[model samples]
Target: MSTLLSAIRSLIFVIVLIVTVIPWALGVLLLSVFRRGDPIYWACANWLKIAIWSARWICGVRWRIQGMDNLPTAADRRAGVILLSKHQSTWETFAYPALLSHPLAYVFKRELLYVPFFGWAMARMDMIHIDRGRRAEAWTKVLTQGKRLGAQGNWVIMFPEGTRIPRGQVGEYKTGGTRLAIETGLPVVPIAATAARCWPRKSFLLRPGVVDISIGRPIRPEGREPAEMMAEVKAWIEAEMRRLDPDGYGPPPSGVAGSVEGGTASGPAQPDPLQALSQPPSRP
Candidate 1:
């Protein structure tokens, strides 16, 4: 797609998002007084579904997912898994709730709760938000809320990289997600999404393309250390990313480092101005 056309479509999609989120947020705020839990959660998720639909029809951004069978079936209420995913763009933040079967609680920064209508609506949901400055308090919140959410059949989703990495590059994988899995004794499901192919990190100019999302088999956290388990998760996601989006990875351009051991591509991190706006409201 041409730059001009892509810009136009992205602009239109942004408008759609704003137009939809206003009334939806207001409704969620009103409902919070009377409704709670799954009812309120799905109400917000429904708006996310509409957002993804708008991205498809307006910006021509599409997705193809594999490995639904890898997740626990609806009948398996006793089973719960924490999702550790490759973060490339804002797309997956919106797409996960709409695409996945289970209700997702995102581990996000507490500041997002102040994002006007969107943040206000999110604050009412049963999700985890943390003060990143308070490391101890944050971990405690994650453990407490993670166990509770997991027991309730909601999947806790976190970006192991901590922040969105540029396409074809690997960020330092954090141990928070794996630590939660180990603490909760829940398995971790690794997800590799190529959303950046169309929606590049730090930019809203979405091009026309299919984002391939590959869900790997769940990795058991029993008897596993957080760093070791996170490394394994990182390796699987990075390798799978190469397989799913070969064109995005290869020899790095000038001044960029090449792939390291365990399939991690090293490079300078890009600033995500949209981090505050694009982050899905909740706790991971």
Candidate 2:
């Protein structure tokens, strides 16, 4: 698509977001006073569903996912897992809540709680929002809240890279998510998403294309070191990313295994360029 057309589509999607979030946030605030936990979480997630739908309807950004069977069934109340995902764009952040079956509690920076309407609603939800400046206190909060939320059967989703990395680039994966998983005795599921093919990081321009999301099997944290466990997660996600979007990463360096640096795959590409996920659709 042309730059002008892509920008116009993105603008329309943004307007759809602003139009929906205001009223939705207000409703969540009011509902929080009367109800707590699941009700509030689902209310916020419903708005996310609308956001994802709008992205597909307005921007022509669709997604194909796999490995649904790898996750514990929604009926398993005693089972909880920590999700460590490859962060490329805001698309995954919004799409996960709608796509997944269980409730997800994201570990995010505290500053997001101050954003106008969106942040206000997020503050009310049962999530982990930490202060980045205080590393010690922040880990303590994540441990305590992660355990509590896990006990409630809510999945804690953390971006191991800490921040969004550009497409075809790998960021330093942190051990925070693994630490929480080990501390809470929950397995960690790694995810690789190629949202940047259509929506690049730190940019609003979205081209029409399909994003592939591949969820790896959960790795149990039993007797595993946080750093070591995180490395495994990183390896799986980065390798899967290369497989899902080979054109994005080009070819890995000769000696370096799964090294994606210095490669570039930008702009919209052919629709559903890769094969569909082998598993049957668990959820629409």
Candidate 3:
């Protein structure tokens, strides 16, 4: 009976989300055509703020962000960086773009380009799209796009895990984001979030809860290999996640024996890339 009630409530919430977003999307569309003060950007961002507030008001969900000090406060406004994050829910997908002042270019799968209103907006926003099957070709394309975004002083956000991990466990990191940092000599900032508790992937239900977001210190790739940087960043994020989501929505990888803060376990386990592809999908 309780499950049924939750489902019914979730249905209503979906209605609310659509009702609120559609009109704003239309406004964005018109504003986009004119290429004005980014009506699309402002409208969508304000909508997200409302959405975040609604999640709290209607669904009892709230957000807590920590380690804000980890964010760069320097005068490097033109500095380009690779913002890497743990993928947990769709909330961050919207929240990051709205929350950050710097314009970001996302390296997402080509499929997203087909999404209706959202896809159309992304296209206008100058996001980088890649076909997953064509790994080499994708990398080349990414390099071309990333260089320009960097040179132009825009940030690029990448989910090293590649997709949402419902269980909140950190999958092995994809090397691409790290490689970009190395190749471009840009700093990498790690953002970890637990939005699945509030907005689970693949589900319409939005639970009332406090979501935690933590940004770790940015890593400068100075002379480091991409693989080396990837391993370290992955470890830091997974450890922080385990601390945040203890219910085991996603259990820590078996290969990672020690707690993240205490440093890697003394065991001989080496980091493996395949773990990322094998991670379970979390509901949005």
Candidate 4:
């Protein structure tokens, strides 16, 4: 699409997001005074669904999932797991709740709770917000909340790569998610999402495309070292990225990276930014 058209659509999406978020947040805030539990989550989730739907219709962004069974279900009854995913763009952050059946308790940086109406609404959700400047305190907060939330069957989602990398680029994966898993004795489900296919990092321009989400089987934290577990998580996600979109990650010989199964190309047969990244680095 032309730059002019892309910008116009992005503008429309922004307007839609703003309009959707404002009233929903206000409602959530008011409802918090009386209603709690499922009502609050659904109210917020409805806006997220609308946000995700708008992206599909207005910005031409869609998604594919290869491993839905890997995620926790409502029947699990709070047998919460930690989700460690690859971070590449902002799309996955909004899409995850809409995609999953169980409510997710995201472990995010505290700054996001201040993002005007949207942030204000997020602050009311049963999520963990940490102060990065205080590493010790942050770790403590994660451990406490992660354990409690997981036991409640709420999956704690974190991007091991603390920040979003440009499409096809790899970032340093951290062990925080793995550490939480180890501490909480919950399993870790690794997800590889290619959200950047339609949405680019640090840009409003979106191209029409499908996002591919590949979920790896859960990794049990029993007697697992945080570093080793994280290494495995990073390896799987990156390897999956290469498999899903060999042309974007390091191009191996035609039969090499592209040969890996389940790594469907992002954006279907078409293309755009975050070409192969599976998920967005939340709150960054």
Candidate 5:
């Protein structure tokens, strides 16, 4: 009976995504292209807001956030930043774009670009995609595209660990983000969150709870090579996540304000612009 109930709930969620979310997303995309200023962006943002609310409020799920104060505001305009974040669930993908003032350009696998309305909307939004197998080529593209987008004042969100990691194991951190920061001379802001607890990747039935997101201080790359900087940023993020989840393999990390008995968090430390450039590379 429990299994059947869960399946039924999941089916309903899928129906909503298709019958409602996709159509509305398309309408917003068309609206954004024609409208200017806050109107279009707000419409886009509002659509997402409603989606999030519906998933939680109307669908019987709950949601909360933490360390949002740490997020950069539009005034910051520290353009061309490489925002590295933990990949646990789909929440960050939707929530980040909705909450952040600057449009977020995500680097995702090329395969995801084929997914119906979501992928279509992402294409219109100018999200980046790369062939997963070609490491060096992908890095080059990242550098080129990242600089272009940054100059236009967009934030780049990269999941350094690549795919979503299971609850306990931390995958080997990749070097793309660090490289982008070094090559573009932009800052790296590590964002750690436990969204999977509320919106678990493996399941569609939304769980009612607050998800914690901690934004670490940004690190500016002065003249350091990408390799060394990648290690520094990776270590910092791993440490922060460990701190957030001492057990490293328990319930998801949670925030301070709200608790669901099980939640998790993940980020990195800050470094001065010149400091990172001066450091020697360490072996990963």
Candidate 6:
């Protein structure tokens, strides 16, 4: 596709987003007052679906996924997952609510709550948005809400890297997500995605390509240290990243790992790419 066409499609996506989201946000806010629980979340999710669909219909960007069977299903009622994913672009955040069978609560910077229609709509949901500056209070909020949400069957997702990194570059993985998992006794599921293949971080230029999503098996948080466990998550994610999007890492080796599980195991292992959990997804 020509750069001119790419820019045109991107513009169409942005216009559709602005036009569609305003009404959806208003509707969600009104419904939040009259209704409660999953209905509101679903209502909000519906808008996300429309936005994502518009991107595909207009921009020609596409995606693919593997190992979804590894994730817990809705039938496993009351089971909460702590998804630690790689953060590459805004695409994953928009896509996850549509992809997962369950409700997802993100640990995001509090500033997102101010994003007008989109932000106001999210404010009505049960997500935890915190002040990144106040690390102590912020984490306290995460642990408290994370445990509560986990007990209630909501998956709390946290990006260990804290922010988006350029495609192929590894960022510092924080132990916060692992700490939340350990504190709540939830399993950390590492996800590897290639969102930047289509949507670059903080850029409006949406390209056409398939973003691969690789879901690693869950890591049980019992009897583990946060940093140690996160290192394992990091390794599995980074390794799988090389598998899913090898170009970013130069070339593939003669071999690859058999499985993509980043479980919480005891003792020494290669350090986990853990957040770099900023690895987001798409499967079209």
Each model's TM-score, in the order given? 0.87, 0.89, 0.81, 0.87, 0.75, 0.90
Q: For residues 133-240, could you state the per-residue lDDT of candidate 6 as single tens digits?
A: 998999899999998899999989988898998998899999999998888889889888889989999998899887888787788888999998888888777777
What digit string (tens of lDDT, one per residue) describes model 1 on residues 168-255? 9999999999899989989888888999999999999999998988777777877889998788777667776776787998633354
Candidate RMSDs in Å, in order, are 7.6, 5.9, 7.7, 6.2, 9.9, 5.3
lDDT of every model, 2 decimals? 0.82, 0.83, 0.70, 0.77, 0.63, 0.81
TM-score, model 2 to reference: 0.89
For residue 252, give model 4's deviation from the true position in Å.
Answer: 5.2
Off by over 4 Å in 2: 252-284
- For model 5, which pairs clash? 62-208, 224-277, 237-267, 252-263, 252-264, 253-263, 253-264, 254-263
Candidate 2 local lDDT, 89-145, one digit each (tens): 999999888778788999999999999999999999889999999999999999999
Best by TM-score: 6
Candidate 5 stretches with Cα past 4 Å from truth are 1-10, 28-45, 58-66, 69-71, 246-284
Global fold similarity of model 5 (TM-score): 0.75
In model 6, the worst 10-residue window by lDDT is 275-284
The candidate scoring highest on lDDT is 2
TM-score between candidate 1 and the true structure: 0.87
lDDT of 3: 0.70
Off by over 4 Å in 4: 252-284
Model 3 per-residue lDDT tens digits across residues 43-84: 566776666656665666667676545554334557778889
lDDT of model 5 at position 86: 82
Q: What does the lDDT read for residue 209 in candidate 1?
A: 90
Provide the clashing-pair count of each candidate structure. 5, 0, 10, 11, 8, 21
